[model samples]
Target: MLLQSHLRSVNPDATTIENAAFVAYRKDATNPDHFIPVVPSESIAEAPYILHLLPALPPAWPNGHIEGLRARGGCEVDVTWRNGALASANVRAPHGGSLRLYADGSLSKTIRLGAGETIAWPLP
Candidate 1:
């Protein structure tokens, strides 16, 4: 089967085939037997939306932005996950400071942390 994969070629002018033809050998390898090619799904046309990245850096590499779930102060931090789900954070956020979190690539919550806070989340 001719499976046309949607790989981006650097040279756009490159041609792989001018026509589609299938050659098969019969009983004594004398002639051709014909069949057709089928594409199972339209999903092959392009990559899915998330053939990319998981949004934030883990808590060890704290980015002090709302997009990342890390400490905003001079506090130590740790993040934990279980079975691809966010489990908890060992955060020492200063009073009135907040921790941000993402779920399925969207900003899910922003939590106000008391000093020496340990926070947890339920898995979906």
Candidate 2:
């Protein structure tokens, strides 16, 4: 198999396809994969609605106003991936604040939300 061959070349004694694929996919500098975000459901239960951000964003959306589940002073976002790329995001911010998107320890994007607003922001 291609995975086994790749692994054998990488590590003579290695045998797991999952690990090999993860390393290869993540280290592919030419076309690195998108970072996926994880949101805890319990964090924003009553905010309002969910923002479904797609790879292709819509033309017009309200400024800093998104519909989502109302929560505390923070925001919660969920990510969707397709074919190793980011597909969409569902963001919820009840009290309104800065929603920062990060890749590991690096900051990627920042969005500001109004009170009880939810946004689906597309990431590049």
> Each prediction's Cα RMSD?
19.0, 16.4
Going through the candidates in the order shown, the clash numbers are 0, 10
Q: After superposition, how far is residue 84 of candidate 2 from its true place, in Å?
A: 2.3
Model 1: per-residue Cα lDDT over 18-116, one tens digit each: 111112222433434544444434432221111101234455633222223332233334455544444453445554344333334433233455775
Error of 1 at 93 (Å): 1.5
Model 1 residue runs over 4 Å out of place are 1-70, 82-88, 94-96
Task: Name the lDDT of candidate 2.
Answer: 0.37
TM-score of each predicted structure versus truth: 0.31, 0.34
User: In terms of TM-score, which candidate is strongest?
Assistant: 2
Q: lDDT winner among the candidates? A: 2
In candidate 1, the residue pairs with backbone N, CA or C atoms under 3 Å apart (3 or more residues apart, or in different chains) clash, namely none
Worst 10 residues of 1 by lDDT: 45-54
